[model samples]
Target: MELMGSMSVVEELREHYVAVVGSEPEYHEMRTRSGESVGVFEWPKGTSRMGVHLYASAGATRHGPGAREHAVELFLGVNTGSDAVKEGFANLILSVLKSNTVPQHGVFVAGNWKVIKGRKFTGWVLTERPDDLIPKLQLADGRHVVFLDALPVFPEEASYRRGNRSDELFEIWEESGLKSWDLDRDLPSVIERRSILRWPSWAQRNG
Candidate 1:
């Protein structure tokens, strides 16, 4: 599962992609203060149908001291086309990685799926697995689960109440002067809870 070679493989992949699609590609790296790495590549005008954003990052386990060397993530985003762009990008990724298989490990694909919703933002999901796998997918309301990862942290009821109170206090503070120190001091505990919850799970857990 280890990516044995240098970044040359990635660069080669980008070159081949640009030749086929006929557009310039851009790359960005995301690094943590501790030097953990994340890689991102964007195709501003790679194809007439869509622009692509590809992301990769190392995976870390809870019990490990640092990131798992071989574990990585590959995510793609295709914007500026019909709804088919999402599925198209997903299939392209599968095609590229299928020939370069990684033994004894799993690959996961996830992102925001575009759908017909009344609001500006809509949620959709898709998944495809090898035939030998157990077909881990959810088919409720045109959504499917593709990968198994950590469980999500759901917000509690108290958190919502505090958010509402905080909004009211902020509104009053904006309209009033600094003399409203009593209102600031009387802010609900939910505000602090909400602030803490905004941090990454690792920070919350390690804190």
Candidate 2:
């Protein structure tokens, strides 16, 4: 096994996944419109699939020189390995890298997106990794890469997160007893309709 610091970022991440999940992942290649490509490493976990972006932090814009101490690699969990799901994450990561905004924890990027057909997830929350299975990775250059879970969210859930607190929405998901983050899971918004009434008039009207 290659030691830490000696391995490339992708190699280090692959090793971490192997160590934690005890299996090799299937590599899905995603190409940007500019012809650049990134690998989405996916692993099968029972009825679900977990994917990690291998190049989200390898650049110097978003996670490289611009934000070394706060670098993040995005990951997602879904009910199936849908191409649309992978594309959604890839597009989000690339979009962030190309924009002035840095991906921040507890923030949800809202859009009219359906990661998987027949599902109602309209955006994703950039939250801390669901578990400690994949720990922080330090590169040879001394920059550390943190993993974040790109949890799919409904519009109402996004509103709930914005109006209330991110953790409050997380708590509701925890109480939901459902796979809240799974893109293919047909999960309803856990935020009660009455809760929307407490938000601003704009939010109430929209949500």
Candidate 3:
């Protein structure tokens, strides 16, 4: 979606918050879910570009917290195809929630399949805080869908860690000084330190 459309969604949600809560609630651009920095937005500035992490959170939240209450949860499949579609859908859902008013309480958005012996589903729900709500978004039949009752958690720092393969790649690249200074035998450690700089814009959106 376009930037204007995303801003409109944020504006609509802000209006809904004011209408229901009887006051203008604060709007924050969460940089990292578990970090202390959630960038607050001043209305009229317009919505910032949506990133991949925020997009994923939106999808996870769809089924976890958006669809349920106290014990909100979300489910996802353990495959690549589902992951790609779900990621796109999450972005769409975030766009929708930005414009639409959430129902009084809980809601749900289902997915193609469930993992973890059905203990977790592909979608998410919305509820209270301190509880990591799963928010999810998906696209189906040309329609964008979100599955969370409340806003999805966006973080200010790295939430999920990279895999060993990624680490190895970083180590090799750092030793070559392609992206940073050479630190002798500290190459490995330096690589680990500098790896954080490689996170995509979408991944670091909240910060």
lDDT of 2 at 62: 43
Q: TM-score for all predictions?
A: 0.31, 0.70, 0.22
lDDT string for model 1 (1-207, tens) is: 321223544554445445534565555443333333333345543442333432221221111223223322233333232223333332323322333532222222212221211111111122122331222222222222222111111122123223334334334435544222121123334334222222222111111
Model 1 stretches astray by more than 4 angstroms: 1-5, 45-73, 78-198, 201-207
Q: Which residue pairs in candidate 2 collide?
A: none
lDDT of 3 by residue, 1-207 (tens): 221223433454345334433344334344322231221222121221211122222122122213322211122212122233333333334433333444322333223232112122232223232232323222222223332322221111012122313234334544655421111122233333312222222222221
Please, what is the whole-model Cα lDDT of each candidate in the order they appear?
0.29, 0.55, 0.28
CA error at residue 108 for candidate 1, angstroms: 6.6
In candidate 2, how many clashes are counted? 0
Clashing residue pairs in candidate 1 are: none
Steric overlap count per candidate: 0, 0, 42
lDDT by residue (55-156, candidate 2, tens digit) is 222231243333445556777665565556666666656555555454666877765544334556666687775565458777656776777767877666
Q: Give the per-residue Cα lDDT of candidate 2 at 200.
A: 17
lDDT of 3: 0.28
Please list the Cα RMSD from the true structure of every candidate, rounded to 1 decimal place.
17.0, 7.9, 17.1
Cα-based RMSD of candidate 2: 7.9
Q: Against the true structure, whose TM-score is highest?
A: 2
